[model samples]
Target: MAVGAIGVVFGDIGTSPLYALRDTFAGHHPLPLDQLHVYGIISLMFWSMMIIVTLKYVSVIMRADNKGEGGSLALLALINQHTTGNRWGKGIILLGVFATALFYGDSMITPAVSVMGAIEGVAVYQPEMHPLIVPMVVTILIGLFLIQSRGTEKVATFFGPIMLFYFATIAVLGLVSIAQMPQVISALSPHHAVEMFLADPFRGFLAMGAAVLAVTGAEALYADMGHFGRSPIRMSWLAFVLPALVLNYLGQASLLMRNPAALESPFYFLAPDWFQWPLLIIASLAAVIASQAVISGAFSVTQQAIQLGFIPRMTIKHTSTAAGQIYIPVINFALMIAVILLVLVFQRSSNLTAAYGIAVTGAMLIDNFLLAVVLFKLWHWKKPLAIGLLTMFFLIDGGYLGANLTKIPDGGWVPLLMGIAIFTLLTTWSRGRALMRQGMAEGSIPLEVFTKSAHSSATRVPGTAVFMASTVAGVPSALLHNIKHNKVLHQRVVILTVHIEDVPYVEPAERSTVKDFGNGFYRLTLRFGFLEETDVPAALRTVTMCGEAFDMMKTSFFLSRQTLIPSDKPGMALWREKLFAWMLRNAASAMEFFRLPTNRVVELGSQLKI
Candidate 1:
């Protein structure tokens, strides 16, 4: 598990040595390649990881996992359970959702930056190969997305060993350079960072934007805590990943100190002539691994959003029998296009790096807000300690965000614009779904009342019928439409609703609940955690509680497909209502989403306005 965590979770931060130092010295806000700046940047990078990744994420926030799951949505789910009715709940929820939106922006930029950053090493080794960099990056990234449909289960076995070698190689390179200039190790002290800020606060502030690149994937540890437990993640970080990253940064600094001209390619210069080619190959592989992690993270986040009702359901394919190894074609295509455009427009990793800071820092800042909720309300930590911690985090996160804001015109706007667009989609879907549900429920009859009245009027059929509902209390429109049009009810009638819980996994023992409504009417509620798949047919097979057990061949599933219309409602604006309507139409079929038997499935459609 520790090795897996190193391969999957640390790939992003592990690969940062490629460009973190180079960007700080020669990025958009270029700094002097002198002793003070080099030391200052190194010190800043080290402390940033300590404060942001180690202390904040590993020690503190990982404790807020939602039933062994972690990430903004998972954390928000945990907090929402406790603060459902509080006035502050809404704000925290929005912040969490927005953080999720910014993550989409992060998802788009990571592949572009990481692949280009490593591939550019070829350009460094032979300047004649520079023009091929963009095409090579585009080809590699396209290939990566194309192969996602084939599950990573087989490939994942090798990730641990490959990443282990990569980290060990970088550490060895760092140690060799540090042996030549041991004084570079002293720059890890906090005083140099303070001195840099004291000397020129503005440059220090600007560089904060660049320094944050080193910690871009810090959230992955928390995001992937459920994949490999916290013990393994913390073990991997402190015992291995963290030290290797810090050493590589220190090595890059040492190289710059010896020859300032290495600023153009400090990372590549760390290797000897014979080793440079191998280093490039290893780094490029590492970059692809990092990109794969980001792509997988995006799919996970999208699944969570759909389960949480923040996004419309799309086609989700389980590429592997493993729990979370799923793929979403819509998300994959969107990310591929966005990432390709970013590469084409930016034309260089340095420019993409400029755009990268805002997306990550913005998400980090919002996470600070979520942590405030965790500390004050959930954990109830010591007041003084929580206050001090929150204050420091806000200042650091805010400073990074503010500094990155200055890069808006310098490619940073790419993420900000993407974040805004994605946030609108998320919030709109959430709000629009709420309004739609409320509208649909307004005139709906209760299941118990309807069952007592309607079972007698409709003719009883031979087989069993399952009608899917959004709520347990109300009758599904599909049942009404079926009874009214055909005037027939199955001998065994099941009114079913699938409820997505706030937790990550609902135990099979507590998965289903059935309430008999007398006669042939029964209400069955299937509960699933946000992270779990909504495989209805498979879940039904284990249910002995619903009499005679579920036989898919003899049972027919009925789904209500709502045709949304733009209404003159006060809940959402007219334009948003139209957007919601369009989204509803394009959403994946409930039959596909719930994994119902295609041959035994029926869809009943109804029009509604929200």
Candidate 2:
């Protein structure tokens, strides 16, 4: 598990050694290639990992996992469970959604930048081959997304040993350079970082933005907690990942002290001449592995958003028995286009550097805020201790965010724009769903009243009719339409409502509840964990209340297909309502999403204004 965690979770941070130092020294805002800056940047890089990744994420945030799952959406669900309807709680929820939105931007950048950084090494060995760098990186990214449909179950086995070898190789290379200038080891001291900051406060502060590159994938440790347990992730980081990154960063600094010319490509220069080509091949492979993690994370986040009603339902294909290993083709294709475009636009990893940290720091800042809420309100930590810990997080996270904001004009606006677009889509879907529910409820007749009034007069038919409803207490629109047009009711009527719980899994014993309404009428509420798939037929099999099990031939599923009309409602602007309508048109049908049998299903259409 530790090795697997290292491969999957730490790939982003592990690959940072390839371009992190180069960016700090030769990027958009190049730092001085002198001993002071070298030691200082090295010190800042190490401490940033300690404070942001090790202390904040590994030690504190991982404890807030939602039933072994972790990520912005999981944490958001967890926080929503603890606090609801309050102003501050709503604000936290928005921040969480925005953080998730920003992650899409990160997802696009990671593959483009990481692979480009690795491929750039080819230029060091065969400078004439530099022209192929962009094309090669694009090809690699295309291939990565192309294979997502078939799943990673087979290829995943090699990830662990390959990444382990990558880490070990970098560590050995770093140690060799560090042996030449043992003084680089002194960067472990906080005094160097402080001295560097004291030398020129603003410049050193700006350096924080670039230095953050070293720990870019810190959040993955928490995001992937479900895939590998917290203990294994922590153990991997503490015992292996963290030390290797620190040594590599320090080694780059030591090598820079000897040869400033290496600043253009310190990571590849650290390799011996004979070893550079093999190292480049290894690095390119590792970059692809790192890209795989980010791509998979995008799919997971999208699935969670759809389940939580923040986004329209997309087709989700489970490619493996592992619950965490599903694939979303839409997300995969979208990321592929964005990443390939990024490779063309940025052309080099150093150019993408300007766009990288803003999203990461923004998300980290929000994570700290959510963590504070959990610590104070949920964990019941004392005010003083909570305030103390939170204060520390604010200082670090806020500082980094402020530093990264300086890059906005250069290229950071790319992520900010992407994040805003995503946040708009999410909030729009959420608000639209709520308004649609409100409209449905406003016109809805009481279930008991409907059954009492309609059942006696309507012609009774044989077999069971299952009406899917949004609310447990109300009559489904499909049933009303059926009664109005056909003037008949099934002998056994089941008004079924599916509820998505915040938890990851609902045990079989607690999966469903049924209440008899008398006279062939019954109300059934099916509970599903957000992580669980919703299959009406499968869930119906667990319901033993009615006589005999549900037979597909005799069981008819009814679904309400809502046709939304834009209106002067107070909820959203007319433009947004139209946007929602368009989104509604594209969303997967309820029957498809719920895995209802096609031949046994009946859809009744109704118009809604919101």
Compute the lDDT of residue 55 as modeled in candidate 2: 92
Off by over 4 Å in 1: none
Candidate 1 C-alpha lDDT tens digits along 1-610:
9999888998888888898889988998988888888899899999999999999999999998898999999999999999988998998999999899999999999999999999999989899999999999999999999999887889988788889999999998899899899999999999999999999899999999899999999998999999999999999999998898888888888888888888878888999999999999999999999999999999999999999999999999999989889999999999999999999999999999989999899998899999998998888889999999999999999999998999999998998999899889999999988887898899899887898889789899888899998887788899999999999999999999899999989998999999888787888889999999999998988777777888889999998888876566557888888888888889999888998888999998998877
Q: What's the lDDT of the predicted structure labeled candidate 2?
A: 0.90
> How high is the CA lDDT of each candidate model?
0.91, 0.90
Best by lDDT: 1
User: Where does candidate 2 clash, by residue pair?
Assistant: none
Q: Tens-digit lDDT track for model 2 on 118-192?
A: 999999888999899998998888889999999998999999999999999899889999999998899888888
Q: Clashing residue pairs, candidate 1?
A: none
